[model samples]
Target chain A: MTEADEENGPDSGHDEIRSLVKGAFRGQQEDRVDVLAGVQAKIYDRSGGKFFSDGWSTSRTPPISTYLVTSWVMLLILAALYCVLAPISGEPKRVPTYPAPVRVIPATQ
Target chain B: MMRGLSVTVTEADDERRFLRRLQARDEHAFNELVQLYEGRVYRLVLRILGKPDEAEDMAQDVFVAVFRSVDKFRGDSKLSTWIYKIAINLCKNRGRYWSRRPSEAAEDLGDVEEKGWLEEGPARTTAELSAPDQHVQGYQVEEIVRRCIQELGPDYRDVVVLRDVEELRYEEIVEITGLPEGTVKSRLHRGRALLKARVSRLLGEKIE
Candidate 1:
């Protein structure tokens, strides 16, 4: 036990070291400024817009395409599963597509 | 146990989906990733490289590598773990580059050091720095810690920073370093001892 302690390993209670280590994290939040813009700029320049084609790479805001693509894919998959399984469960006549909204033309307008 | 495992599997699936987005270069996914990891990468690089400006550039380089090659990520370990591996690897590479061109690296970084940083901070002595007025002396202690951490050999510094400073798990450290578990343990032990000796010397204490 004494030998291990002498080594000052993780088992040792060196709170001072731990406390001081926070120094690494200390600095202006400005110093720790967001690198996303820099990273995007680099990737865009390096790849010649192979990545920045849509300007999303340079945009700080999260791209809408991310959520849209995932939602659309998942929705399509679920709809397909429901449509395929509907027939197996004796519901083939059910349609997956929503009926188009009725165009109620104003009568004799 | 079963519930825990299902939760774990679900998390893995979620990560896989996220990884796919990153691989596909989904703009929002990439943005989210940079925001999520920029702080951590900055901290690790700052501690390793020993300068805020250099750390920022290094951190940027790390994310660039991550985005470019994210498709190659095999998911053998967690995505964050893979990112740490990249950060540490880049730090090592930059460290080597600096050492190879001492005149240039020193000239550039020395200027940063001279302009209101550790070597110029108040509280000259460790004892004075350790006084109860943390708010007053905090900067000095922080600078001292940074210098001491930088002073150690890279082998020792990496383990010390990852284990003591970052407080990562042994297994995770092992993954980041790709060092054997036993080697990690031994190096961590020796690193801590060396750090303690440095601190003791700073305090002008006699330690066997």
Candidate 2:
């Protein structure tokens, strides 16, 4: 036991128990069995062997179909907004353009 | 520092790859997962259940549940944490079932007594005993510690096992158990105190 263990009054036996527990569990291993095979068989049966291709993956990215549908929906919404705003706003008030000055009076006829 | 960062990145990538393979129903990835965690799961279940047969069954069940629900694993926590949660929950359910069945509970209790460690006389002085006798005494002490741990309440036992035996960090334990940190700390504190008192008595020492 260390001084620190002693200082913690209730921990006097902590080290002893910890060591004994570790020893008891150290050499312990699960009995040899093909757990993977068992699990795979179960999953296969549950999913009718379609699990390999059809089960959900952990990936969170949206599917291609979902992305395509979302993009189309957003485009439709933007088009609708433009239609609603265009007539109300009209075209930008056309700026009146001034013609360039002509110096035709310099002919000494 | 750079090496450590790279190691962390590699581990993260490996875990992501493993998850992908598991999701894809790759048998090899499943085998590797079992190889990596089966022993720890077995030991944790054994400590919780105190019966080898049941612990073995429980450990297998944990993996099955993990495989079934691999898609639900959102990477919110470490895979080990999720597995621990499954094991702990299964143990808790088994405990509850056992409690409702008096005959089985009695049998387990009887087994504890039949082990005869607690009934053994006071601890012999190690200095006075022969070498073989000293060894026997030590073994008895170990048995006593194991029994004492078994006798702790489920809440305390779970925290004690996770913290002391498994040596998980407080945050990880909280994630596995879904308990607040304060609750985990208090339970651990009380569990240690109780274990200390029991072991001290078993060893014929005065309790401070």
Candidate 3:
């Protein structure tokens, strides 16, 4: 035995008490297993069929598919908005440009 | 050295797999975790609360919390250590709740016969006793020890239970309790000394 072990060797009194404590609570209760199942079921129900989904992943970030779908949908929406708001360009509109203002000042020789 | 490194790598890989399975809400993985930890959690809570029903409920609550927050576990510590922290926190909360309502803290010790361990007697030593007599004697001593443990303050009792009963390492105790290592050692020493003295007096025997 190590020196430390010898120094803190078991005492009869302590051993007796320790044994008593162990004996008092020896067996594992069976109901705790049932409790575990019940809690798992509760968690499953609360998660609402999303327990196995990517939302519950360790990183808990949105899935790539979600981001991809969202980006595509946004692009489609923006294209639709542009189509609705922008005027149909059949031909170039007539230029209504006026002549540049003639600023003819006296030439200083 | 290579073998040790391999063992470490294997353990890390296993832990990673377990965490992935848990986060994926694998029923088998959840069941395996529960089976591994439920007894220890229940026993720890029972030691703290001293009520079987409450301990059972708290044990369930601990696992439920773990299940709900499995995605948040970052694998910084052993899973058992995290579970122990949850159990300890729940026990502390329940103890505080009971303390707030003094009426609920009253326990009946009368169910066990009050045979003073310190009483002067020519009783047979445990070694000399028959098997049945030894069993009875052990039961009586256990009852006394349980009462003594219940009488200890929550701080002392928690340290004592984690150290003596659960047989956790000092570092693990520190992690679970969030106490400094020095404080954990001191509490454990004081708690053991106190139990030794009390049990010695009760048994009419020297502890050291």
Candidate 4:
């Protein structure tokens, strides 16, 4: 170990590095591990290849025509929904207002 | 999308068996593969990225890429080497695209060391230092430890961190870095000297 340590260079600060590493390990930043696991999960979900699960290309369509047709159908459905639900009407809806004076009653005895 | 060819299970040797299963798109083998090197990959990425969240995302990206491209992984090298190549490439892209230069990286030495000493409240930062503390933190110490590492002319930094902090064997490092063994050893020696000088400066500051 000393030879290897000496080979690395002057032994001036070797102790510092050793202590720093020990401290860092003692910190045991599990958050780092969790974050890494999250990455694994994301990759696994995207490429893990479970039967009928999340992945890059879930449905492998054969041709451009199939994609085009699907696109058209989806567009039509979206257009229809927009037409029905959109606030395209020029006039705003009228909410009937009641007189405010009726609620302003005199202070109770 | 890469093909959905099923991974083949064979009664062959270890590498062959693993490779066969991986090539055939066996999710079980893939999971096992992930289990094997997830820690190393994550640690490598975290060291590069410095942020837990970003490292995690990058690590996953590396594995996902591996999963998709396993078919193309000719067993010309060790599986770990191949995986490291993919991981390093992914980390490089992430670091590049995210504009994460080593210059912008934070230094943890003082904070880590201080915490080790105090065993108390949150670590004190260089910014909040008193004049005495600032003087104690000499230019050479600052230059040698923090900036020297950051200024280590990118090539050295990667090799140094990979070899020292991550503790990869020389051959494994050479495989991943594509540097000659002699070059690797040379850089390690130089990098260690620089690091030692920096650490010495910090100690001197404390004594003063």
Count of backbone clashes for each model?
Answer: 0, 0, 0, 3
lDDT of 1 by residue, A41-61 (tens): 888889987775565457787
What is the lDDT for B133 in model 4?
Answer: 50
What's the TM-score of each model vs. the native? 0.70, 0.66, 0.66, 0.53
lDDT of 1 by residue, B139-166 (tens): 5445555777787888989988888767
DockQ of each: 0.21, 0.10, 0.13, 0.06
**Ranked candidates, highest TM-score first:** 1, 2, 3, 4
lDDT string, candidate 4, B66-123, tens digits: 8778899888778888888788778667656656554545655666455443322222
Native contacts matched by each model: 0.45, 0.22, 0.32, 0.10
Q: Judged by DockQ relative to the true structure, which candidate is superior, 1 or 4?
A: 1
Give the clashing residue pairs of candidate 1, or none. Answer: none
DockQ, candidate 1, comes to 0.21
Flag regions of model 1 displaced more than 4 Å: A1-10, A13-16, A22-31, A62-109, B1-4, B103-134, B206-208
Please say which candidate is ahead in lDDT: 2 or 3: 2
Best by lDDT: 1
Candidate 3 per-residue lDDT, tens place, B83-137, comes to: 9988888788877887788575554444333544334432233433468856566
